[model samples]
Target: MTTPTTPPTAGGGRSEYLHGLDVLRVVASAAIVYTHLASWISGKNRSWPIGDLVNAVTSPLHLRPDLAFIGVASFLLVSGLVVTRVSLRESPGEFLRRRAVRVLPPLWAALILAFAVVSTGLVREMAPESAATALHLLNNAWFGPYFVGGAVLLPVVWTLLVQLAFYAFTALTIPLLRRWPWLPSAVAAALISVTTSLVPQGAVGPVRTVVAFLPIVFIGQLISLAQAGRVRLGAAVALGAVHLLLFVRADLVSRGIFTPGGGYHNVLLMIVLLVLLFMSANGPVARSRWTRALARRTYSVYLVHMPIGFAVLELLVDAIGASWALLISVLVIAVATELFYRAVERPLERLLRRRRRRRADLERPVDTDEPTPGGNRDGLAGRGADAGRSARQGADIA
Candidate 1:
């Protein structure tokens, strides 16, 4: 069997070597973890002027309010590029199995843990209706908007929900997307960008939220196409970048650096940077062996950070005092997150892959040695292929 060229952690020699983009992806994930840990590890003291002053600067630093977005948005771009690339190459059967086994399980772990904390009333202030939302794995609207900043448990899972929707659509549409090539992505980006100015504030659902991002995701697909000589890189890059900026700005929603609107434009730029990183990543990224290693563990840290971040922040409050602890807690969480990624998440992923591969091989059809009982032996291979093809088409339904 041909091994695909995806990032491989140190677990197996067979791992897909991570390009710079992959390493960057993990860094973003870790940052999200650190950002949340800042809140979690802090102890509450209402009246400390000195503490307040320190926290004012330190908390934002961990949060990176300046670049809060690049993490999750880049997460989407990576998913879009990688998933679409997989969608084109792999059979639907393999894609679904790998996605389910590789991604959904670990994600579900964080969601369940978060729900447990909420249900038990240990953390009283998370959104109320989020219980139902949590069951859907953060796809539901119950969690509300407060957690949009990646400060809550399973925060990153929100991106996965959008990804699932896109993947579901892409699975069936891949054949068609392959045919027309540019139609789905072009329409998605165009409609979102144009509609952004049209829609009033507080619009909800896909259009108000991630649906608008369809164009952004499609742009990644476009980037991939351009690289393959399917389109002109200069034209795609130029048009895509312009729309991306305008979307990020979102027509002066808040007119501040900290505002979150105008994701379209930010995402556009993020994707461009990702493309560039993927191209020139080797020299700078590969140079730092430790940094690349850190990238490998990023997802693991992301999964564990939500619960741990809060605990760390809460503890930091008493140990170091509110303001100072908050500063130190960020560092502590970053170190702990690295440990978690190395110890738990990465190992489990490798184990699952081994078991999955073993099962898949065992399940492969075994030819019979018996002579043909009739004039023509049954064409089981053809039947199996047809069955698989039908199932793939059916499961792809949105």
Candidate 2:
């Protein structure tokens, strides 16, 4: 597989890789886990033998503040920034192909395991029909109620669908964006802001959720462009302020657990993260092998951690006591997700890319002979082409 390339800093030397982004990923993962664990602990009809104790310990957290949703939005922001940086170097077709290969295989692997868990009747709350559920979920149309009767085995997958839509939109718009990136992005942000304002807070279902979050994604794009000097910093800041105001005005900021004290904390947290993103844009970030490894597995962790953690919690809570069950569940699910990354996600992604490259090779016209040495022949020129292609591939994976 091609190695990832760090985005160049505004000062023009080879910029340091963004270590803080990975730290943000880690934070997002933890926030999501916290939200889900709270949900599991406080879920209704708790007839498990240890329910009373579990509630006693975690009941303070029973407040349904959706910190997970905040984390998801943050993820989309970072993702949008990264994708915009990458797409500048890729054709639309190449961008879509690489994205599909990078995301779909691992997600499908997670889905298969998730389905197996559901089929065993472990997930009694939302057992899906074996065949139809697999097909519908695999298809992953942006509409809600992925399975029949509006039962979603893995509600977390909804964000993935929104992400896919964003990818397609980005791919389609890359050409237009090349010329006047700022104006279009600003207009799009405004549109999303208006849309979100029109939608009621509690009434944001699947479609509305995607619509509301798109502005955050646009903010990421704008920040990236501004960081790269393609857009004015002042303009980007103005647009971001408008977007944040719209988001807060919609009451969306108050929906999450991290939003203590009437959502000021949420706003502060977002500003802090954005400041970190800006600061990291131009500086060397400390890195280590451990962080790199964890960063590599973040997506896999995002995919499988929630459902598996909940499953483990349900299976072990009564027998082991609440604290131990929660602890064991986190560790077990994390390790299992890491194993899944190594065994299934990585291999499947590599295989898909190999097949894609092979297909492209077959489609290219055959050259009977190498070019003459003086005529820009195969050594340096060919290597340059290969390097560019590799860079594009690497950027996509990032």
Best candidate according to TM-score: 2
Count backbone overlaps in model 1: 19
Per-residue lDDT for 1-398 in model 2, tens only? 01225333222212234455665656667767766765676573344445455445644544224343546766777777667766654578878988887887777777677777776665554344452365555544323463223556566777776677678878888886667767767666666666665655555355455764566667677766676566777887887777666555545432431244454326334643653554363223325556556656778778787668877877887787666877898898789878998887678666755765676556444774444332112211112333333233234333
lDDT of 2 at 300: 79
Report every candidate's CA lDDT. 0.50, 0.60
TM-score of each: 0.63, 0.73
Overall local distance difference test of candidate 1: 0.50
TM-score of 1: 0.63
lDDT of 1 by residue, 144-166 (tens): 33334323444555565566667
